[model samples]
Target: SSDVVAGYLDAKWNWSTLVGKVNSSTWKAHSVLSTTDATKNNLVGVFYNPTTTTKGNKVFLLAGSLGELNRSGVQRKRENLGLKLVVGDVREPTGSEPSGRIDWAEPTSPLNESTKTAHQGNLTEFLAAGGSGVLTEDGTLVFPLMAENGNGDVYSMMIYSTDNGSNWALSEYMTFAKCYNPRITEWEGSLLMIVDCENGQRVYESRDKGRTWTEAFGKLLGVWAKPRLVFWDVSLHLD
Candidate 1:
């Protein structure tokens, strides 16, 4: 009955938000960083590193600022937002020492603060990176990054590492108008990415251990919805 109830509700609602709510509640505090500005929202990604399991379990969170288009007829300026990575020890109830605080080891790119004259309030776009991170059976960590240029076009970069988080290699660039809310899962010895586009859901898969990706399930129903994949012995579950 619990499974049935969960399945029915998950099919109707955004599954990613539900899991995020659960994690947010149990994780004590919202580990992700947010800005004081009402227009800006934090884009976060969480994943568990298995290869480094012996050393210590690490949870990776990345955040960026999103701009809101002004309602006034005058042109509005976009503020430069920064991306921060917060690493925490998953084994312990709370992170140990600096583990709980926000640490800046590296940023995706420098913040961009510029005004949009042509689009004005029409530009409801936000720039965010790092929301989808998934662990593999072989103890590899894979995640996606959102990169935008001066033209406002969005691109995706898949980053992966075999030797834990010590070194990372970048995959080829993916062309997508607007992409966020990345979810990854390993099915039948392969890695799959469920990415959210402005229109609908797009599924990408990798065979060579996440070096690259090809569209597996093209534009599934409910593209705007974010979904998480989980594997169980009995049945495949979505949450």
Candidate 2:
């Protein structure tokens, strides 16, 4: 609540972000939130919704780490559009952590060490930031999934929940064999998933909104470490 840099874009694409805050307790004013604190999770997206009661108006804070699903206490208000919101904060009521911040101006999205360990299994304990999440035009919140077995074998799978974060199930094994940390983007009416391994950078394309994926190989499909995908200005780019 105290450290937030918020911005808004009007109909003209003119934008502005908050640069200062007044500390209520001491009434001391300070500059904007530190850049180091905000970009830790490695992703920031405006989970767009075009088919909801809100007429697809922006949903608050749908852009955090992948453990977002396990944050039980944070309230998600996008069930009307099948997107879940997750928030993390210090559990101690008297602790220094800011109140479970829900600033539309600046959403609180932290990848946390959760206390509710029942549903998380080992997934919560490890590096849970699998990939950038996507909200489909059909209103499904799909996360690039990484599933690990008791035998310590890790497999890539896709997970989605139509009812926000209330229920989730594996969509399918990724189109490639033995890959993890899949980055996905939607372009030209297709879902493009990219990942890299010892073999090379593998490209997977899904035309049916993630139900099925096909291997789309390219010249640069190999000779790289793990790769990530991003979409901007009607183009899909790899990073």
Give one digit per residue, the lDDT tens place, for model 2 in 34-138. Answer: 323332233222232111111133332333222112234665322111222342221223467433222233333222223213323343212232346677776
Candidate 1 local lDDT, 27-143, one digit each (tens): 333323333322334322222211111224465544454344444675655554433334444432255542333222332322223422232222323334434466777787766
Q: Rate the local accuracy (lDDT) of all candidates.
A: 0.46, 0.42
Q: Which structure among the candidates has the greatest TM-score?
A: 1
Pick out the ten consecutive residues of candidate 2 with the lowest summed lDDT.
Answer: 46-55
TM-score of every model? 0.48, 0.45
Candidate 2 ranges with C-alpha deviation above 4 Å: 1-127, 175-177, 218-237
Candidate 1 wrongly placed segments (more than 4 Å): 1-56, 65-76, 90-132, 176-181, 196-200, 217-239
Mind sharing the TM-score for model 2? 0.45
Q: Report lDDT (Cα) of residue 37, candidate 1.
A: 24
RMSD of each: 12.3, 13.6
